[model samples]
Target: MLPSTDALLDGLLDWVRIETHTPDTAGLNSIMDLVQSQAEGFGATCQRFPGRDGKGDHLLVLSPWGDHAQKGVLLLSHLDTVHPRGTIEHDLPIRIEEDRCFGPGICDMKGGAFNGLAAMRAIAESGVTPPLPARILFTSDEEVGSPTSRSLIEDQGKHAKYALVTEPARNGGHVVTARKGVGRFTLKVEGRPSHAGARHWQGRSAVTELAHQIIALEAMTDYDREITVNVGEITGGTGTNVVPQFAQAEIDLRVPTAEAADEMVARITGLTPKTPDTKLTITGGMNRPPFEQSDASKALFDHASTLAAEIGFELVGEKTGGGSDGNFIADRIPTLDGLGPDGDDVHTLNEHIFVSSLKPRMLLLKRLMETLS
Candidate 1:
């Protein structure tokens, strides 16, 4: 039996009350405890992997019927949000306004996580063991690039035949079949320092060189190929009196394919300093590979489309420039993403999910889990 709206709302509200900011491992651990208890209530055995690099640990919940040989479905989600601990109390309070539920992280992910849990419970109550076993992975560092959870996500992706990411549905109820690869690079320039007023001509301005590099980097953006480069942050110079001896630029890169990622990295690294006295060095490369559309992914989308129609909602797939752990898993498996409920104003004080979407999306998830192999 599917959980009632009151029951679902109560649960979601409870979850939204607890804030699991990306850097708050202790808070994340508390929420994971709640999620573990919920999953275990549905007969899923929970496993914990300790977090690294000061992030919260990860939880893997395996359904009672899961077996080593099944190579089943992987349901992916994250517990961390971009909001800090006090947002719930200060900026975004828990409130139900007409058809929407307002709170931080409510639309960004907690609502999706709640719906997913509800679907699992419905499955358990239905007495139908799915043809494909299921593993639900709740990661803790996704808001900050998923540094600790990437390897674990990939390892599970290798075992699963299909992956469904419960990220919030995009605007207009579109699911994601593709996501751009995301990466970061830092360029540092070392130059000779001299007194600004006394020996300006003797000094090599690292800031000047970095400014030139930023222009060059920004020019690398190719809208036609869906490639973009941004020099998002830069810092240099000690004081007004000093000609900076060192400067650095932090760049953000996005690409539509692995080949594009490689080519962009090469281009960035191959940059030659126009200034004679400065030496430049580059660091960092691609983080997540692009989730390009594949035949297998398209077939998966077709399966989901039929299931959505049976559930009485039209479904469509979209491509996005943003990257997620979905990007990490898609390169290895047939991944279907954005299966979460509809929402708007994600990652803001106005963040909210459609209250009306909870049950239908839950039912849709239940049907897909029950029917998909």
Candidate 2:
């Protein structure tokens, strides 16, 4: 029998009370405490991976009963919530009103994490320990792109035959099949400075040179290939009277292909100085690798769909513009994501999770573990 929805809901409320925003060390620790306490009850072994000190931390829990070399799944979810420190701590009450459960981090991840534990428990009680293991990794920095935890995810991902991510599905519960690769770029332009009024002819404007670069950068965006170049932030001149000596701007680029990522980085980094009077510098590279759907991923998706069908949910796939830790692991192994409870308005004050969706979704996940045998 599957675990009760009441127990899953209680566990979700327990997790949401922790307030694990990445920049808050205390919050991260609180989340780790919550995770460890919960996992320990089931005889699972928990480990803490200290993030760059003062930058928060991540937690990993391995159920002692499964084996990886045989054929199991790797479960991934983030512990960190985007909420500011102390804002949601002990304040976001878990409520079931009509169709949804209202609370911070409930659908985004905490609810999903609880479901993973529940699924394992269901497996254990069924007296069917699969030949493969299901490894759960809950990172604290996924809200900020998992910079410190991607490597670890990839490392564990390669060992598992399948990967299941617990990120809320988009378009009303359609799972994710593909996502774009992301990159960051910095543009620095330097030029000769002179009094704007006095030696105007001898002066070269760095900001003026930057304008040309920005235009060139924007033109590089190819909508046909789903590539975009955005100069998001800029800063420059110190005084209105003086010619600016330095100007800098940050560029965000996204591509659908790995080769496109390489091409974009090379071209953006090599932007020639517009004027001999200006020197330019560009830095930053690909962050999240593009998730190109492959055979392995398709197989896992098929399996998840089968599980969802048993629980009366028709599974469908969708493409996402946003990146997730799923992209980090998918490239290395068979990965399936967007399997968590449905929700909307993430990163906003109105964030919410579907109460009705929890039981069905949790049941599907519960079977995902039991069927592993």
**Top of the candidates by lDDT:** 1
Give the 10-residue window scoring lowest on summed lDDT in candidate 2.
85-94
RMSD in angstroms, all models? 1.2, 2.3
- What tens digits encode model 2's per-residue C-alpha lDDT throughout 1-373? 7656677777688777777777887877777877788678777788888878456777777766765456567889887888776566445555677777777777777777777777776666677776677778888888877878888888877777778888886778888888888888899999999999989888889999999999999999999999999999999998999999999999989898889988999999889987876899888888888887889888777888998887788999987877888888777787777888888877776678877677787777767766654
Writing each residue's lDDT as its tens digit, candidate 1 over 43-78 gives 889999988889998999887775746798888989
After superposing all C-alphas onto the true structure, candidate 2 shows an RMSD in angstroms of 2.3
What is the alpha-carbon lDDT of model 1 when measured against the actual structure? Answer: 0.88
Ten contiguous residues minimizing lDDT sum, candidate 1? 61-70
lDDT of each: 0.88, 0.80
Which parts of model 2 have CA positions greater than 4 angstroms off?
Answer: 68-71, 89-97
CA lDDT of 101 in candidate 1? 89
The TM-score between candidate 1 and the true structure equals: 0.97
Runs of candidate 1 with Cα error greater than 4 angstroms are none
TM-score of each: 0.97, 0.92
